[model samples]
Target: MSLETIDLSVTIGDKQILNNMTIKLERGEVLILMGPNGSGKTTLAFALLGHPKYQINKGKIILDNNDITDYPTYQRALMGLGLAFQNPVEIPGLRLSMLLNAIQMKKSGSSFDISSIDPKLIIWARNKTRELGLQPSFLEREVNVGFSGGEKKRSEMLQILTMDPKYIILDEPDSGLDVDGIKLIGETIDSLRSAGKGILIITHHAEITKFVSPDKVMIMSKGKIVDEGGIELIKKIEEYGYKDYEGVQ
Candidate 1:
């Protein structure tokens, strides 16, 4: 089973952002997508997750063997797809604890009933917060509200851990993180990879590669994958930049 995009093309209004792009992510593997700015990396991530704004002008998104190109965002989540946004939104009044509980219920296919949840789940969440180096009290705060950049990344990890999705799409998870924060995020990603989850990481700066070894790397330009290779491709890009691949098809 795999998360596969076949000949995918996307547009926003009249302008095209992705053009005949295709990629595959299998379970128990990590695929890193790197590109210069405006290369449509984020657009591909959004299209995979069924973002309404990214109109799929062509191609299909396959989850396992199911064609999910037309699935709603919530449906995709239920099909074991998860995305950690680059800029997580702040919900002023919604507590993090509440959100986690909701996600747990959705994953379990159970009716929403906070009163029926086991006490152990609450304990488990608190333990996760501490393990991620977050304060136990942070779980009580509104989701991402007033969180620092590092805190926001950690918070997103908290959700991913709790949900335990089959495939995860992380958009620039290393951005805005300090050295220690990057280590923490990298460790979290390693743990998930060890658990046999498929991961797709999109980044402009390849800093996270130092911590987590990606199985394959793809470079994008003009919304298409220009080149793909093993980890060595990352090093090449780091040294020479995307100049040589600017208009490659």
Candidate 2:
């Protein structure tokens, strides 16, 4: 009934990026993963989503009591797991609407004529874009092409809304955003959490935490979770910094 990583260890080629990591993300809760650079936060996100580059040396990924350690990326998505990348890739020829339509088909497990697709779905996507403060014309443009930092993040949000996965992983979602952009993204995340979705957000900054309160905050260092606590932990990191936790478990 939950997405859990048990004793997870990930390696890329000869280098080990994550070591004996274990965590659980439950339904209707928000978990924030925070760490300095190279602490394996993004690596954990990639491994959880079955990214090929992150080799799971040991441990299991269970989603709703189903072991998905061997599942492929697309299969994980089909199982209601979604990941929003820190740096979303730009597809020059793929229009936003086209990508959303493809996601809808994948979610429904069936394909119909483009014209026969549900009009309400299209309207929903449009409304999501508008709600995120994006222009309607963005639906016609190529995905992530010529998008500003905030626009790119909003685009990722649009995809997340369209997919409607059971569990969501967002990596550095607040990076490169201005004040207003951060506020908008924070509100969007708040709405998602209120909707009872399991969410794991990765970030180094504490600004976003001001808007969206997480149920748990985990600090990572050198591929291990160094410390875990509530809001007090975030305040400690902001004041004392991560120097004391550099290599300590």
Candidate 3:
């Protein structure tokens, strides 16, 4: 049972973005991919979710032994693949509450009043908003519209929780969080791991590594994985820097 990419190479326009990258995240484990800017961490996230802009030159995306290499983005999501964006986008004219209701409609074939969301979902959303240090009133705001960085991240989590995909890809989730926010994220991640969701966290910041002890850490350089190991690899990278792993096979 795994969500993985095998021998994947991707290119955008005439420029190659990823080169024969292979990554695997088993159920109930957390894998961290760390790299400096332009190392293709975000590109991997996009490719895994089947973003059309990234052309797959060759590779296979296997989700729970199912070949989803050619699956569309929404199809991949419906098949239990999920992502939390590093920079969440705002959708004008769309209330967060309304979006949750829409997701329920799409996923469960559930229907409800357009004016009122399911009461249970509202309660859950309210609790989640509070747990993420957001006021329940946020459920009423337009998605990511007028939200602070921390708030947008929390909003993304709320949606992810509602969807509850089995495999989660979080793109720099701790990028702009304070201590409390980071701790809350750590707790959320721990819960997800316990619930048996395979998670891949992409980040260059080591602060997030302090909160959760990952099963494996991968160092990506110039679109390829250069080094991979346990937590010790993180410490080494911290001391000697990513320069040590550059051009390393």
Candidate 4:
């Protein structure tokens, strides 16, 4: 399975946030998007999930060869598309397990059973939480209600594992993480890659590439992908930063 964006562009009023951006992630491949702040990385992510604020002025978002640019967020979720937000909102009165059970039912189309839930999922989540230095109790709390930055990212990662979608788009998974937190996030991506999941990771930090060894790297600036290359580009960015590369004003 694959997700491809063809000549994608998004505009809000007179501001064009993304300009003819094209990107593709095949099954089991991880692609990293690197750019400075306001470079439209998040804009592209939100557009893929069909956010109402960012208007899809022109372009098509295709998942597994089916157009999904006009599909609602929930519909897209049901179609094997998952998004891990940069800043997840706090939903009061919602337990983490309850949310997971709902998503589990949606994906597997089976009756919710905490006892019969997939062992692999529970094991992975347990291991990930331990690896991230989080308490097991963290998983039982409300979603992002009072989570720290690191906790929130780990929570999002757990959901991704549970959903096990065909395509996963993560926006800035490394932003507020410390060394261990970042490592856990990288390990999670590596696990997903090994399982043949298509991943699109939006991040500015080059350290994340060390963990997942991205197949492709797309550099965005002013809402356009100005450069695309391999892991070597990640090294160059580490040495010289985005200013040394082309297309940034």
Q: After superposition, how far is residue 127 of candidate 3 from its true place, in Å?
A: 0.5
What are the per-residue Cα lDDT tens digits for candidate 2 across 1-249? 689999999999989999998899998889999899988999999999998999999999999999999999999999999999999999999888888888898788887445555678778887888888898789989999999887898899889989999999999889988887788888888888899899999987788987899999999999998888897888888899998897697
Query: Candidate 1 clashing pairs?
Result: none
- Could you give candidate 3's per-residue lDDT for residues 1-249 as a string of tens digits? 999899999998878999999889999999989988988999999999988999899998899999999999999998999999988989999999999888877788655558767899898889988998999999889999999998888888889898899999999888788888888887898789999999998876677777777998999999899988998888888888888876586
Cα-based lDDT for every prediction: 0.90, 0.89, 0.88, 0.85
Native-to-model Cα distance after best TM-score fit, residue 165 in candidate 3, in Å: 0.4
Residue 209, candidate 2: C-alpha displacement in angstroms: 1.7
Candidate 4: clashing pairs of residues? none
Better of 2 and 3 by lDDT: 2
**Which parts of model 2 are misplaced by more than 4 Å?**
112-117
Q: Write the per-residue lDDT of candidate 1 for residues 103-163, one digit (tens) a residue.
A: 9988889888866655677899999999887998998899999999888988998998888
Ten contiguous residues minimizing lDDT sum, candidate 4: 113-122
Candidate 4 similarity to native, TM-score: 0.90
How far does residue 34 in candidate 1 sit from its true spot (Å)? 0.5
Error at 115, model 1, angstroms: 5.1
Residues 1-249, candidate 4, lDDT per residue (tens digit)? 689999999997778889998888999999999888888988888888888888998999999989999999888888888899999999888877767777877787786665555666566666766776788777678999999998899898878878888889999999899988888899889988898999999988888876888988888888888889998878888889888655453
Question: If ranked by lDDT, best first, what sequence of candidates would result?
Answer: 1, 2, 3, 4
TM-score of 1: 0.96
